[model samples]
Target: MTSEADLAWIASVVGDPARLRILLSLMDGRARTAKELAFLARIAAPTASGHLAKLLDSRLVAVEPQGRHRYFRIASPLVAQMVETMSAVAGDASPGDRRLRRIDPALAAARTCYDHLAGRLGVAIADALQARGHVAFGDGSGEVTASGRAFFAALGLDLAEAGHGRRVFCKPCLDWTERRHHIAGGLGAAFCGHCLSAGWIRRHRDSRAVEVSPEGRVALAELLGVDGQALTSGWPERAAA
Candidate 1:
């Protein structure tokens, strides 16, 4: 049985409204400075920090030091996976197929936290990979295809070199928004890094939402075989070039 102290630890952190907002903010899969998180959560800077501190203490979030800037992010993708999975079960759910319909709405577009996929970006990436034959879902897991090997090589990622054992290579994460599976695991982390390094995407102010550059669109298409122009018609023209 779970101990009361364990329950208390979780309760102390999660029962908070602002802290919860902070977690939601990080769902975009990008690292954010504390000031940006404060704005995103609509809390004062000090309050945001304190709440973030509590989350950090609980291992629900992590920090990155970039020169003078200190950025906060979800501690790990496991946190996102746990939160999303719990959300899927709805806590009050019964043992049945009724669980299939629950979906997080905002995730249908793009969102993430720290170093992993979240929201719509997560959902779409997973879909595109599967659709284009780079991946396939089976046997309670996913596998990278031969096509995926060439695909990653083009982006300059060699997952084989990223190391083996004690790390998941490819895994499906449930998208909170679209109620579908998206790619997670080591491969997902690598993809996010590639996007950032290539300047194909950027984070918005005070939100986990990602803005895909027009160039990013073209880059994604070139890299992942996605149709950049067709995928996002509303992206400004300059970025698309």
Candidate 2:
């Protein structure tokens, strides 16, 4: 059971601007070195180190030693979900808000929410799946239907293997940018991996943004009836409804 004290403690750890920045920097599901995290967080190395130490102690982040350097990443999908939910609450900017304009177009279109996809494209895909009766969302969780399993199987994704981990197999993750739910959890991760391996999506070199390849447009249309072009170009107007 969680106590009020525990909640307050976590809030303090995550409330610091610098630590929040560091946490957001690792939301791409990539392990980053302290130096890299410092640069990304726009803080001095020492400051970043202190923040990282706090996060480590809080178990919000984990570190792995790779050769001579240590790389840090968000500890788990649950932590990532918490951060994203908080971000959504904090970033309730109106559509006309200047802060919204400052957002990277590509990032707003398609990006990774931890290991799974998020943003307009992600939401669109989820919508498509739900529309096609491939997946169903209910009370923040999701269920992959019989046809859904067959659909993924046809794409060479084995749902049994994807669900082997302790993580939930399918769930709805609220999208901070899209103000909608995109699929998350183990199934979501497996699908994201399949997209990458199939060359349907390419991650940006410096950011969490993902670009849908030309082949991706055709493939998604054929496979899931998703409009990759419109999603990647800008926000879908219907999504605002």
Candidate 3:
């Protein structure tokens, strides 16, 4: 069970907008320098340093030092989940919250939830997998079926290798923007990695939004029967590029 002190500390660490921005920036599973986070949060270096120090002390974030550089990232997958869930719960936009409202469309289209995909594209992939009998869902979790194994193998994904980690093999994450279920866990991460390596999706710098490339459109359409053009139809030219 969690103690009151733990809850209070979590609240305090996550309560500040600047720190929240820093954490959100690290949600893509990449370590970032203080300078990068400072730029993303639009705060002064000194102020960002102070905020980072607090996050480090609270164990909400961790750092690695290599020569003259220090990179920081969320402490663990658990930490990432906490931040993502909080972002989902607090996602309702106020009438005057123009900044968030503007980012909403892009975020819903294609974005990372920690190491896995969680957005329209993510939800679509999940649906395709289930529809084709590639995966089975039950009791809030899921597992790849035999046909699913064969399907991923054709794409060069070895489920055995992807399941080598200590994390759960497969699970469902509620998409905050889509309000639908997308796959999470080891399988989800592997699929995301495969898409990235295959040039099926390109991630935006300093942002969670991803763009599905033309090649990706063809591949997804052929493999999963997903309408790639329709998926990206609403995206601006800039986003597609």
For this target, which candidate reaches the highest TM-score against the unseen true structure? 2
User: Per-residue CA lDDT of candidate 2, range 1-241, in tens?
Assistant: 4788888889999999899889888776667899999999999999999999999988888776657788788775458768767766778733333444467878888999999999878887887888889999875479999999999999999888889968899998867665557999989999999999999999999999998898987897778765657656544445533
Q: TM-score of each candidate?
A: 0.49, 0.58, 0.55
The pairs that clash in candidate 3 are none
The TM-score that candidate 1 achieves is 0.49
Instruction: Judge candidate 1 against the unseen true structure and give its global Cα lDDT, from 0 to 1.
Output: 0.68
With candidate 3 superimposed using the best TM-score fit, by how many Å does residue 181's alpha carbon deviate from the native? 0.7
lDDT of each: 0.68, 0.82, 0.79
Across residues 48-151, which tens digit of lDDT does each residue of candidate 3 receive? 99999999998888776656778787765457667656766788533323333444667778899999997778877887788788988775578999999999
CA deviation > 4 Å runs, candidate 3: 1-100, 232-241
Q: What C-alpha lDDT, on a 0 to 100 scale, does residue 188 get in candidate 1?
A: 82
Error of 3 at 221 (Å): 1.3
Q: Which of the predicted structures, 1 or 2, would earn the higher TM-score when compared with the native? A: 2
